[model samples]
Target: MPIVQVEMLEGHTLAKKRLMVEKVTEAIVESLGVPADKVTIIIRDMSKENFSKAGKLACDQ
Candidate 1:
């Protein structure tokens, strides 16, 4: 079993997220030889204000 975590800024379309999961699952299945049903994917979405870079909030950039 493989547990994958992905974090990204909010507002991604459902299509994009679906494609991401499909690709990620394929990679995991190919690399780890794990069953697709056994793989776990966790996606966390946050606002731009929740992240910072160079001492500035991402939302401010």
Candidate 2:
């Protein structure tokens, strides 16, 4: 079984997430010989305030 965890800032369409999951699962199944049913994908959404970049808070200046 393969477990994939994707963490990113919260702002993605359902279609995008679905595509990602499908592509990731296919890759895992092809590369690791895992069954499609055995692959699990988890998407974690974080608020901008909870993330930062370039020494600055993502939600603030």
Candidate that would win on lDDT: 1
* Model 1, CA-based lDDT: 0.93
After superposition, candidate 2 runs with Cα above 4 Å error = none
RMSD of 2: 1.6
For 1-61, candidate 1 gives per-residue lDDT tens digits of 7999999999999999999999999999998898999888999998998998799998999
Error of 2 at 1 (Å): 1.4
Q: Over all chains combined, what TM-score does candidate 2 have?
A: 0.83
lDDT of 2 by residue, 1-61 (tens): 7788999889999999999999989999999987999999999999988888898888996
Point out the worst 10-residue segment of candidate 1 by lDDT.
Answer: 31-40
- TM-score of each candidate? 0.89, 0.83
